[model samples]
Target: MKLSDLAESQILKAQAEGQFDKLKGAGKPLNLTADGGSAEAIGFRIMAEAGAVPREIDLQKAVQEQALVLKETEGEDARKRELKKLADLQMRLEMEREARRRFFGE
Candidate 1:
């Protein structure tokens, strides 16, 4: 059989086996905003729901977490390391944000 046919058969078999029966938000409406944004917004929502955020967003999250840890840290060396990490994440996030803004003119 052709490759597409084989892929379809595999997907059908998985469905028959209930492999996708208990996914998160399985029966809930998607939490998309009603602002009628671009298709890119829809794709971003889907990717976020799947825990696949863009690098800038991910870096921002990391920076937040690192800030929390830095606050709780007590040792001098550890604090320095955490500070360096936070700075690096912040720089990367800035770069990614600028790139996205340039590409999308946003």
Candidate 2:
């Protein structure tokens, strides 16, 4: 059978018989072929391959974390400080989202 027809490129008997059990990175995903040809897209793909997460996502996570902290904060002074932090994070997240929407029209 052609390799493409193989189950993720593994024969069931070979897989179950532990033939590939000791191979490096077994059971892990392989990088499939990509179709992007533009330089910008290639740059983006390289950045993604290098584990770059977008600023918008980071800001969103920050907002969530700040909100959680605000929930657990005690005392009026501490609560006020936490609220301010949460507000700042939320503002940043909103700004990032707005920028993305303006640029991408999403």
Candidate 3:
């Protein structure tokens, strides 16, 4: 038999055996962003959900957390510090995103 036919046969056998049932997000729509960029976004989203995000995505997450903290901060001095930290993290995240875009020609 041809290789493609063999593969299809195996897939059909697995399906009949219910080996693909009850998988995560089985009935849910994919959470893809509207950016319509490279498939890396989907990959990154999956990794992020598993707490294994890449450095750039991790930095972006940190920036978001810091922004929330800054909003809740009360003291002027503390808020200023949080703002500075948030700015630094945002800059780093932006740089990493640009580098990836250029490298992937996205």
Best-matching candidate per TM-score:
1
- Candidate order by TM-score, decreasing, is 1, 3, 2
- Candidate 3 segments exceeding 4 Å error: 1-38, 45-52
Q: How do the residues 1-106 of candidate 2 rate in per-residue lDDT, one tens digit apiece?
A: 8544664555676678887577544577543445345554554554455466778767878888888899999999999999999988888888987886676566
| Candidate lDDT (C-alpha), each | 0.80, 0.72, 0.80
Each candidate: RMSD: 7.1, 14.0, 8.9
Q: Count the backbone clashes (under 3 Å) in each candidate.
A: 0, 0, 0
Cα TM-score per model: 0.58, 0.54, 0.56
How do the residues 1-106 of candidate 1 rate in per-residue lDDT, one tens digit apiece?
9766896998799789986577566678655665256566765665686676988778888999999999999999999999999899899999998998877678
User: Model 2 compared with the native: what TM-score?
Assistant: 0.54
Per-residue lDDT for 17 in model 3? Answer: 97
Mind giving the per-residue lDDT tens digits that candidate 3 earns over 1-106?
A: 9766897998799789986566556678775564265478776765666566688967977998999999999999999999999999999999998987886688
Give candidate 2's total backbone clashes.
0
